[model samples]
Target: MSLSFELTQSIAIIGGGPGGYEAALAAAQLGAEVTLVERAGVGGAAVISDVVPSKSLIATADAAVAIAEATDLGVQFFARGGDGRPLRPQVAINLAAVNKRLLALAHQQSEDMRAALVAAGVRIIDGHGRLEGDHAVVVSTGPGGTDFDRIEADTLVVSVGASPRELPAARPDGERILTWTQLYDMRALPEHLIVVGSGVTGAEFAGAYMNLGAKVTLVSSRERVLPGEDPDAATVLEGVFTRGGMTVLSRSRAEKVERSGDGVTVTLADGRTVEGSHCLLAVGSIPNTRGIGLEEAGVQMTDSGHIRVNRVARTSVPNIYAAGDCTTFVPLASVASMQGRTAVFHALGDEVMPLDRLRITANIFTAPEIATVGWQEKDVTDGVADGIVHKLPLAVNARAKMMGVRDGFVKLIARRGSGTVIGGVIVAPRASELIYPIAIAVDRRLTVDQVSRVFAVYPSLTSSVADAARAMHNVGRVAEA
Candidate 1:
C-alpha cells in the first residue's frame, strides 16, 4: 500500500546497498522524495563484490560437481588415447573465465538496480555520504571528491554495510594472502588454499575450491566447521570435506599468515604450520559505521560500532533509522531489504510489521546447502523453546535415491502441545529453496498437521519437507497421548 502524507517528505539515505536501495525505492513509491548516496555502485557490496559474485562462483563450482556426480547416474564420457585406449573424461574449471562471468553478472545486477532506482524517481548521488545531522546528509561528490552537496530531509536512513574482518597479524596483500573480496583477481585456482576459519564463509570457499579441483585445507578454531550452525548439518559437511580429500584441521587457530617463497605459510597458535599457494581469511565482518557522524547525531551505537535499532529499524533518534550490517539486526541481504521497507513505512506513518529475527531464513551455500529458519534443535535442547523435534534423512526419500544424494536430512521443530511449526532445518541440494515453505509455516504459525495437509509435488525433494511435517504430526499425537 502506498503511504500518503499531507506534505511531500524527503528521505536521505547513506550507502546504496540492499537496505539503502530498497528504502529508496519504497520511499519513492510512497510519494516521498528520496535521495540515495553511494560511494560504490548502486547494489553496494552485496551485488558488486559479495553475494552476487560469490554465489555465481559457487554456481559454476556446482556445475562442475554435477558433471562428476553424473557418472554415478549412468552418464558416461570417453576419449580415445594415442594408444587407442578409451580414457574417462575429467571435469576441469577455467578460473579466469568463471571469474569473468561472475564479475560481469555482479556488474549487470548493479546496473539493473541503478536503472530501477532511477525509474522509481530516486535521485542517486555517487560519492561518500555522511550524516550532517538527523535531518540532513552531506555528500562528497566529483572526480577528486573535492565537491560537496548537502541534502535536507525529514528522515535519514543509514545502510552502510560491513567489511571482512581483518586481523593484525594476517593482513591481506590482495595476492597470496587475500580477503573474500579479493578472490576474483586470481587468474587460476591456487594449487592449495588454506582457509583460516571454519565458519560459513570459510567452509563455503573451502568446499567450493575443493570441488573446483583445488587442494584445500580448512583451518578451524572450533571442533567442527560451521560451529554456530546446526551440529548435524555441520557433521555432514565436515564428513563430505574429509571424504572429498580436503584436509580439515579442527581446533586449530591461525596465529599469523606470512608470505613464503612462491607460497604462504600459516602459523598456528599451537606452533603448527601449513603451507599453501594462497590463503583466505574469513574470520568475520565489522560494520562500516565509523566516521559517519552517527555519534554526533546522538544515535545509539553498540560497543562493536553497530547502530542500535528497534524492531522497526528505528534508531534512538525518532527520525533516524539504520538497516543492514550497520544495524544490530540479522546481516542478510533479504533481511536488509525488509528492514529498509519497514523503516520507510514506520516513518511514513503507515502500518508496519516489525521484523522478528527468529523468522529470518539463513542459508550456507556449500555443496549441499544448509538452510534454517526460526528456532533450531539446539533451541529446544537448551530449553529456550518448548518444542519437539523430528528428523528424516534424505536417504529415505525416493527423489534422493534417484539423484544419488546420500547425505542430508530435514529436521522440524514445533510447539509441544499445539503442534505449531516454530522452526526447521534442511540440509540438502539447494536447501535454500526447500526451506522457504517451512519459513512460511513458521511465519504463519502453521501446525504440523496443517503443513502435512499441504500437497507437495511428488518425486521432488520438497516431498521430504511434507514427509517430515507429516511424521511430526504423529509424534505430536503420541506425545499428547
Candidate 2:
C-alpha cells in the first residue's frame, strides 16, 4: 500500500499504555489532534494487572522480610497460644487483604493516567481500535460487538502490548494454577508453591513467596535464575534465593501441571514430579497483535505476530507505527514509553532520535532488584569492545552494612582508552533507583572520571555507584580488590 498521507497532524493511538499515552501527550504538545483508544483501561496491563499489582504484592512481602530481619536489631516479639505456650512468633499474612490493596493501587494508577491524558486535551475512546486500511481504523465501542466507529488519521501509533504466555499443558485456572495476572486474587498463601520457568517473573514471585513464609520451589530451564542478565548479578541473586530457603531447580524443565483433589503436581520432561499446593507459570508473553488487522492493513509482522518496527517506531506501512512489547523484543515499560514518544516525533516531522537501546535502562523487581543499562556485558566478555570492569561488593558499603544487606554488588564498565561509561549492573535493594546515574552517564557519553567527579550523598547506597565509576576510571582498580 503506497499510502501517502499529507501530514494533517491528526494522530490516532491504539492502546493506552506508557507507550500509547506518552505518544498521545507528545503529539498533542506538538499541536496535533490526538485520539487514544483503549478497551480495558488507561495505563494498560502494565499498571492494571502485571507491573503495579506484582510490585505491590512484592512490597507487602518485603515488609514481612524486613520484620523478620528485625530480631537482630534488638526487636523482640512475644505471642502465646491458648495453653500459655509460646506460639512460633507468628507473623501472619492476609493474602486477600494484600491482593485487595494491590488491585486498588493498580486501578487508582490507571484512573490517574486516564485523567492525566484527558487533561492534556487528548480525546479518549473507551474501545478496541484496529486498522481498517492505510489511513483508517475501526473502533468497536459496543458491549456485545454490535456497534463501530471509524476514525481516519494521518498517523497511527500501535502500542497494544502483550499478554502473559500460558502453556497448553499447564493452563492457568486462576485458582490452583495461576498466571502473573491472576495471582493477585489468591486468598491464601500456598503451603508449597512451584514456580515454573525461572525468568524475571518466576524468580521474583519465588523470592516474594519465600519472604512471605511460603515454601517455594523455583523451576528453571536455565542454569541460573536470570540467565540474560549479568552473570555475576544472576549468581548473587541465585545465592540469595538459595539462602532464603527457596529451592532452585537449576536446568530443570516442567512438562505439565495437574491439579488433584488437594494439591497441584508439576511433572518435569524427565518424568520427575514435584507436588505443591499451588503453581505459577511465568514462561513469558505473547504480543497482543492478532485480530488487530495489522497485516490486512499492509503492516508487516513477524511469524509470532509481533509488529515489525524500526527504532523510530515506524511499521512497514508508511503512516503507521508500533511500540512496546507488541513491536519490540524488550518488555520494559520505560523503553515502551520512549518508543512511543519517538513515533510521535517522527510522524509529526519534528526532531526525533531513533531509540538507542544500548543506552536504555531496565530493571527486574526481585528482592535484591537487578538493574542494568547501556552496552551489554557480553560486549566486553566477547572481546568485541575495549573496556574495563570495576566491581564493589555491597557487603563493604556503609549503608548496605547498616541495613544488613550482604549479597549484592555494583559493577561498572567503561571504554578502555576514553574511559567513557558504557555499561553497568547493580544488584541490590532499590537497584532500580541506583541505575539512573549510570544510565545518564551512558546516555550522555560521560567518561568514568566525569561520573566519579560528581558528588554523591555521603554514606548513601548511591555513593557505591560513584565508587565503582571511580574504580573504572582507574582501570579495574576495584576489580583487583
Candidate 3:
C-alpha cells in the first residue's frame, strides 16, 4: 500500500545523523517535500568519527591477535632476528593510511546518503539550523562565518545529536588531552594511554588500544567497568582486560589532567596521579540541545538537558519533534534511526508505533561483543520483571570449544508464569549478529518454547542461544504449585 502525506506541507530536518537522514528519506518517500540541514558531513558521528573509525581500528587489532593465536592451530613461526625471538608479530599500522581509509569510507557514505536524498527530491542544505520562531529557521552556513539564511517549513524534526562531555577542570586541548572524537587525528601510536570513563566507549577504546600494542590504563569511578552493562558480561570483560595487560583502576575518578612536555598526567580525586603518553576522556556525551530554540518554542527539557519527548517523539510543542542523541532515549544508531522514522510517521498523521524501549537491542563492540535486549537483572531486582533467568556458558558449546573460545555465555529471561521471553544477553564472538533472533523473539512476544522449537545448526555458536531458550522452558512448570 502506498502511504501518502499532504504534498503541500514542507518538512525540515536538523542534523545529519542516522536519525535525521533516515527520517528525511522516509519523509520524502511519504511524498512530503523535505529539507535536511546539517553542520557536519551527512553520515554524522557513527559513520565519520566514532563508530566506523573505531571499529576499523579494532579490525586491525583483531587481525594482529588472530595471527598471534595461529600457533594454536599448528602454524609454525621462525625468528628473523639474531636474538631468536619469533619476529615479534611484525604488524605495522600506518595511521595516515588508516585515517585516509576512514575519511574515504565516511565520504562515500555521505555521498550515498546525499545521492539518495537528491534522487528522492529532498533538499540538502549545508548549514547549522536553529529555530528562529514557530515554523521558521535561521541557517548559519560556512562554519563560524557570517553566512546566514532563513527558511520556512510546516513540520520540523530536531536531531542535533551529541558531543563528548568534557571535564571543566580538564578541558581537552586536542593534543595531549583528547576526546574519543580526536583520536583519529593521531598519526603515531601512544606508548601509554590513560582512558577516563568506564562506559562502553571507554571500555571499547581501552581494549582496542591495548590490542593495538599500547599500554592502557582504564580509570573508572564506578565499582566495576561497564557498570551499566550486564553484570556477568562486565565481569568477564574485566578479567579479559586484566589478562590482556590493561590496568583497570576502579573507584578512581580523574580530577584533573595536565600536559607536561610530550606527555600528560591525570590526577585522581584522591590526589594520586598517573602519567601517560596521552589521555582520552570518554566520560559521557552531552546532547546538542542548546541554542536550538527548543526552550523558546515551549519544548520541555530534562534536568540532564535532554529534550523531553514522548514515545512518538513529540515534544511539549506540538509542531516541534526531537529524536536521536538529542533526547533522553538510549544513545544508539539503531534506536536513533527508529526514533527518526517514528517522528516522521507521527508528524505526517500516519499510523505510528510508539517507541518501545524494551524492544531495543544494543551491543558493545569489545573483543567479544556484548549484546543485550529487553529486561536486565538489575531491573528485575527493582521489580521490573517477575521472570525466570537462564544462562548457558559458551565453554560448553561445541563451536566455542572448537574455536578455542573459553569465555562468554548466553542468558535469557522469561516471565515466570507465561514463559514469554522478555530479555536476552550474549557475550561471544559475533554476539552482535547472534542477538538478532533473540531481539525478534522479544519484539514479537515469543515464548521460550516457541524459540526453542526453531532449528539451530548442530555445532554452531548460535546453539548457545537455543540452549538458553531450552533452559528457560521449565520456568512455568517450576513457578506452578
Give per-model TM-scores. Answer: 0.98, 0.95, 0.96
Q: How accurate is candidate 2 locally (lDDT)?
A: 0.88
Best by TM-score: 1
Which parts of model 2 are misplaced by more than 4 Å? Answer: 1-8, 79-88, 476-481
- TM-score between model 2 and native: 0.95
lDDT, candidate 1, 1-481, per-residue tens? 6566789999999999999999999899899999999998999999999999999999998999889989899998899999999999778788999999999999999999999999999999999999987899999997787899999999999999999999999999999999999999999999999999999899989999999999999999999999999999999999999999999999999999999989999999999999999999999999998998999999999999999999999999999999898889999999999999999999988889999989999999998999999999999999999999999999999999999999999999999988999999999999999999999999999998999999888899999999999988665666678
Ten-residue stretch with the least lDDT total in model 2: 1-10
Model 3 poorest ten-residue lDDT run: 1-10
Q: Roughly what TM-score does model 3 have, to 2 decimal places? A: 0.96
RMSD (Cα, Å) of model 3: 1.9
- The alpha-carbon deviation from the true structure for residue 155 of candidate 1, after best TM-score superposition, in angstroms, is 0.5
Q: Of 1 and 2, which scores higher on lDDT? A: 1
- For each candidate, the alpha-carbon lDDT, in order, equals 0.94, 0.88, 0.88
Q: Which is the better candidate, 1 or 3, if ranked by TM-score? A: 1
lDDT tens per residue, model 2, 64-178: 9888888766776777889998765878999989999989999999999988888889999989889888787789999886789988998989999999898989988988998
Model 1 score (lDDT)? 0.94
